[model samples]
Target: MKQLLTLSIVLTCLIVVAWSVSPGSTNAAPEWQSYAPPHWILGPIQGADGSEKIVLNNLDQITRAKIPITAFHFDAPDWQSCTGNLQFRYSDAVLDQMRARNIRGLFWVVPLIGLNCPEYQVALANNYFVKDAQNNVIVTDNFTGHGSWIDYDNPAAVAYWRSLLDSLRARVGNVLGGFYTDSVRPDKRNGVVAYGEAYALDLLDYTRTYVPDGDVVFKRYGVNTPSDAWLNQYAHVAYVNDLPTNFSGMKTGIERVFATTPLMPLPYNEFSGFAKAAPDSETYIRRMHWGAFQPVMENVPFGKQPWDPSFTPQVMQVYRYYAMLHRELEPYLHSYDQAAFEDQTPIFRDMDASRYSARLGNEFFVQYVTDYTPAVQIKLPPGVWINYWNEAEVFKGNRTIMYRAPLGKEPILIARGAIIPMRVYSNLTGHGTGKSEYALTVNVYPIDHSTFRYHDTTNGWLTFDVKGPTRRVALCTLGNVPSEPIIYRIASIAKKPDTVTEQNGAVGINTAWGTPLPERNNKKAVGRNASGWYYETNANRLWVKISTLGTDCPAP
Candidate 1:
């Protein structure tokens, strides 16, 4: 659309861009805000209502969950009666309503053509479908009534699709944030569009041509052999497999291809309730708590997919909160592909700490965790990690403390000056420990905002926002990485329920969050007579006496 030169080749179904060194207009793509990652990863539709109301209503359930609806394939031969105008697929007004509440739509586009559909026929007449080695049209299904495939290599198809996208813009405008194809099959095999990665390359060009300028993604399962450097040329994100929990495998894949890709933290389904039967509250809390540290995160709700009555007040509150957080972190989610290339970290094994983080195409993500317990140390990207949610600055470090943090007790430590309003997780991976405020025993950091810069991760630059949020000590649940930032939010925490804590802020917890076992916030009570106080049995609050620390009063 910017009139930039795009590389075009036939059979390969590919296209490339030549970044004009000469400064052209610096127009940026749009992004979505206030939405959860996704819920129903993929499945068949029942007698479900695809109506905007039905979907949005159902989406209102998970106060904290953002549902990603994958519309049923329109190319199904017998789906005529069920089919609606493409305009109805993504209604602008409907999206506007959802936006008012902070919900996002993850659109799905399958390239396969339908044989019997007049639309597919029109596509072919306009030279749309992809061709085989022999130049014959390749269709998506074997069903007698389906259309042919849109040649990834077909210039005609690209143009038509691009034109179709214009219609989308005219009809829907700025409602959605991200775009991903159900599959990018040049043919029907569902493999990456091949012949030298033509499939993916062309798709990117297509996105630039039509859809809102933003991240374009794809889905992968099983031994997803990405042409790494090659695929990275196009795809900004990938929804990989839902099995084997290969965090390392995922990490390796990302490093080779898009090292900074944002992997969706979940069981792939994004809708399962694993925390339901978690061993303990700490385990449940840790999952969402830990995920909070990652660059990107997606959580599927139990029944918030395609159909539902409506969002209850509780669910609405949570959804609104997460929506606000998502907006705050919007600028950093530039390359969903580069953020979580593969899954290499072991923290994902806890089922509670499936960490997921992403820059809004914004900044670099750097952090250090002291064992996977309830400790964390992440650095904020240089620039003002604008806290879009509350308004504050993050805390810089070199400090420590001890506190009485019991189960269900999260004493929050907000820097009020770290550049953004930070949200502490009750658990990792979007799950909540049902606790309010995370409590830190000891914390040491530069609690000032004088030195941080804003981060832009996409171009890997340190571009400061001229008119960004200027609020200090903003309380936020999301952030954008800028420089070699560091964090100590979960530096040390309680591991159990009802553990003892000294009045001096030393905590002794015993539960599933048993991390940094060596560097606990509060160790066992010391020196008898007024040594330390204990936590109330079976209660979430901690109880400590001041007389316990003796001359160590004030804990130097």
Candidate 2:
């Protein structure tokens, strides 16, 4: 006889697990505001060095290599006519190409207007530039040349800056994703107006208005900086200040991420560091591993191409591996980002300050190796941790242990009751394509009971609950009906189940585990209606497929 269970029993003991989903009318914010940043943000290559040809070439290289990147960042020189003019230099052809590929164009902007540009004279005539006590325009020589800072303190100056942004957006059209605001330092001042926290905050807020739907405004702040408190609300994404391109720089970048992620949202640093000479192959791969787990995986290489002959082939291999890994875990990362938005909870939680370790929500814990040595000492939190790379290997928590993390690998431990939801790998995010259906794989490591609240662009919200006391495990689905079939891979099962049943009836146990059916003649192939159970003796894992077509489950 089928066992009957009460819904309240499952609801009471289950740990809540939430994963990424499509934005719905859950709050007062815009629907797009609920969306997280893309998994990979590419470019600003060589800093302030950008051209139409350069941007196209990099995109071509990345696309050919099958590396998925949703956004491309153009440095200050790309849009500036004479530095800070806020002009559009790229032709319509460039914008069309980006739009066709569903790629977002992120252009760099600043508060200063170059003295050589006509816009500067207009601002000066209108008293829009910050002025000294002597009533003279405060001209400061920066990287771009002599420029006057726009008086964000003055309403007229703010309106003029907004007009410039409006003009640029009108020219670029839909491909203009957002702006990258740099050089908003707290130290800039004149005798009358000071560009401090309020100025910086207002500038960012104004810049965010220009960003189109499903885009972001990348700001540079929050590493021992003065405006750390306001960054969370102002910027969509916050980046660490530039660091040297070396092992020490990687360590500092990690420390900075530890410091900023607690207060800010989507904190990241440029992969391979930003200063000094280009990173060696070792530093590049190691840093890339760390970047894969960050809230945002950004790649801004300095010197040669990532696939250039200067670096070893392993560098590109590791880069591609981690890039795909980041995209695969998008659903997982997006869930935490959404949580940080709804509640003020930190996305990445620090486990130990002395050790470079942190937790990504409640699912996984990561320990980074800062130096050249592959041996790492990890202090685990209280629980049972399963090695993500090797599911069979498990360890008890609250004790420190030495683990080997060679190149191309890092220490990632999954909690015992983690319910990870993932999607198939793709070279693109299918942003403008309007894709609706997606195949989902839900990995469950059941202990007592756990629930996963999964979300996506197509399927609004679906809940998966797993409960077990001993060897018997029961899985249930609630909320919206899934568009496609779901494959549940239950891990750590010591033996094959005697019977697998759903609401319909008994589920057939396939004796041909890991073997393709006659129709599909591939090793890891199954039919669309492949709803059954398969047990792999070697791994002690059970695979079950539940078909959603013409089936009804309880709604949440």
Candidate 3:
């Protein structure tokens, strides 16, 4: 264990240097931003275990359906041989298709070098395999067959494996977007302590040197342990083990994920059968909604896509709605990313590890934990919060109640004076577009006074302030103000606004009389109430477009 700790320190220092010299190291984007976006950790889409033609068609169906996939990751039986050799049999046509669609390709890889393959003989001749106490080759059970792990501690082994990965990239093109570093702990190999963890670390070093722009997400075991403890500081993302798709497994998995807080900033739970199981549509929808509130979402099922024939119309509606909701929440998600990178704070966490409820420790009072049963209730921390869906449904915090939300509704709570940016669009592809047509709404809920710092690629970091007592709110651009027009939509306002004004970096409005043109295009094909900036008088929610405030009131 002590030797392992020393090796970890040395490797971490080297990796830190490699990370610093990587492509985007000097850029404004956070280091973690290299991976799939916060809301779209797409596809465990290990293509159907058949031929190359079947694999390409599976990917084609997803792209044709207009489903948003950030990256495409395929494991064994898709393109690579089962002997754990580096040989791939896929056509360049599939690579061209993926590139044309702007999707990243990720291949699954492990440290285990196949014992039966020709590479094993080469490794043995080169003395690159991990050896047992008797100095014989160490073989272990793997996905396809028995294999020996590359002795990462040996310089020759490291050079050989790194060359192999580089050779794979040469054959596969640069489409290889990093790897899924699988299984950190070896299957009880002697004469080596924590060799699996060391091997995974070296693999990451190779990825950083080769594909600096790509990402690496690991599985369980090695990370968070004492010998491999730096994972807490460097691991950008990780996921819970494959739990059963049933409710009990999901509940247990979610609880386990919550416990990984602050240590791992962006961890997710993998629930099986989301797309294929139509009978659990309701449960699936609820889980989907809950997933959006997570730090990162990975909802790929083994069978069909959610929008495919397997799902009912209603199921599709709910699934797509949450998917859109996830995209819409990107701006808010980045703040947490900034926090994790800059301050080592986990944004998606329970109030405490003991609690099951997940909380976004942002400026907003967002919590995503409540039972699905009728008359279900949730206890919250002390504060005043407004329901994000209805704005009228106000709740004083620190209590439980007979609050039963309707199906398909997630309990999104916003603090009274909180300000959250909204980038609204019809489809998933519109996320991070910064397009003018994508209505950017600044949602200010009922509050006294609050201030939030929001960051984006377009806007480096800006401060939004709300002075509730004086009925004044303003946006201060700490960096550059983005191109998207800022639309201030204040809810819980008592009276209507007669006029709107923009001054001192703040937009003021008396009433939303003739502002915020009714959405020119109705793009609610997903069945969500995609109402673009409307007010509910009885509900006391006033939504006035800030863009119209500075200019002539647009015709609705």
Candidate 4:
């Protein structure tokens, strides 16, 4: 027994040391690659119908309701003057409105030119499209009518495509966030499947120049095949193919998210599905919960608005709760995204093949229930896990347990000794805009020695260190002190500490659990310039407010 225990300790130490020296540990991602928009991207397309009015009204409604959204994705007629024409229809003023709300605009575009589009003749005359064996333009019939696929392999064709996109930029000005490169598949009649990959890759590479830091392309994963691994570099964000609005579709979407994360780190599906009929309230809420935890949370209103009167109020309430939660977790999500880009690690790590669950980096383990039955069996990883919804309810790891997941709640387990960096939820405004200052809240679950390399949007990177022994716990921050204040909430501490000390040798007194620290000149003013700690008896959590106005804590 002693030998096994010593071996385990050595293994744990090695793992910690490895993490401390990993690439993500030493350097922040490049400035351009580190840019992350609000995760809750709203795609307001009701079936095949969408208009500029619909797009603007959806943004207005979401803003009026105080729902969080940072980007609005325009599908079909919203951006196309004639279907498949690479034409910009919405006026620049519409983009101005979006920019005023701090919301970016993503327009749907395709490589095909419909027969009725004026540009079709131009493309055909110039041999810009693929030709059959007889050297005739290969016109294929699709849902949008007959069109010819652009021969992206041809240099002239690619230049013509670039010119069209340039026109869009000139028309829309700078508010264009990116393009949704859908329908890039070439018709089989042309006998060239390789052209589709070129189309997606070239388009993404060129369009990335428009928004150098923002997500430049949202494409379908594996349009060619699952093994087309080269697509990952250009697919800033990828979604599964359109699915039915049913439980089966929900299950398939979850499976695809798990299956594709290895190749495409940022994978998500339309919330509540996008095909067939509208989703029922149960399916919608359940799927929304799953979407909330994914690396990217997107909602496409296929049949009815989430606030429609047909569904129960609980549906909208749950949607609001998860949306707000997703916005608050941007810091946590972006940090892992940086690690994925730098280390090639998946943002959502699959836990079990047979179950619908994944670990969001080392911080969170989430189990998504895909069926009507609320009961679920989950086998946790080795360590202590805390129920995210109810921190008071704890579970021992390396064991299987049947958990009851009632509506509006899913199983989200926070690993013991994990540090999550998040922004204050209440500070968010309409269109998911927030204050300019970097007021952060760090949630720490201290068990043993743990470290988290946290990445912020404005501030580059910071490391959080925590050491929790039998009766003592110490938390400190290292690297790049944030310009704003930080509040640290340390969870799972069973008893009040005898005394808490900061790096400056000032002792922190235990205060009421919910007491708010006073602020002087927008900075936390603890008792006599010494920070303070609070203990919550019910959850066994401690709260500490450290003001990093002009100084940061020394390394622990």
* Candidate that scores best on lDDT: 4
Give lDDT tens digits, candidate 4, residues 85-137.
Answer: 66777666667777787776677676777888898899888999877789888
Ranking by TM-score: 4, 2, 3, 1
Clashes of 2: 4
The count of residue-pair clashes in candidate 1 stands at: 134
- Residue-level lDDT tens digits of model 1 in 140-248: 4433234455554556666665565565456555444434444334343435435324544555555544434344455544221234333333333454433211233
Best by TM-score: 4
Candidates ranked by lDDT, best first? 4, 2, 3, 1
lDDT of each: 0.32, 0.62, 0.55, 0.64
Off by over 4 Å in 3: 1-58, 171-174, 184-186, 189-193, 221-228, 273-279, 302-312, 349-355, 363-372, 427-441, 469-473, 483-489, 493-496, 511-556
Better of 1 and 2 by lDDT: 2
Q: Model 1 — TM-score against the truth? A: 0.46
lDDT of 3 by residue, 1-556 (tens): 2232222223322222222322223213333433333333333222333577766875676666454555666654346664556666678887888778666666667766676678888888988876777998877674434777677667777777777777778877767776665553245623343564565566566666667566666655333221224445346766665555555656766675665554456666654323234335656666665566666555556555455565566666665566556656666776666656655566764454343465676544443433456444567667777776776677888887555556677567766777777665543432222232355656676445566677665646666666543344333333445455565556666764444444423554442233223432222321122233334466555444433222222111
Model 1, residue 198: distance off in Å is 3.4
Deviation of model 2 at 326, angstroms: 1.0
Residue 391 in candidate 4, Cα distance off native in Å: 0.8
TM-score of each: 0.46, 0.79, 0.77, 0.82
**Candidate 2's residue-wise lDDT over 1-556, tens digit each?**
1112111112123223221221111212222234444333322212224676776777777777766666677765555667777788767776776677677767776677888899989999999987777988878785535778777667777778878877787887776666555554323432222254344445444434545243444444431132543454334466786787787888788887776665445777776677548888888888887787777777765555578788999898888777766766777776666556554456677545468788977888998777788788999988999988788889999999999888887898999999887654542321101111145567789887787776653665666677673565666666666666666667887876666555531122222122221222221342234555556677777666656432233211
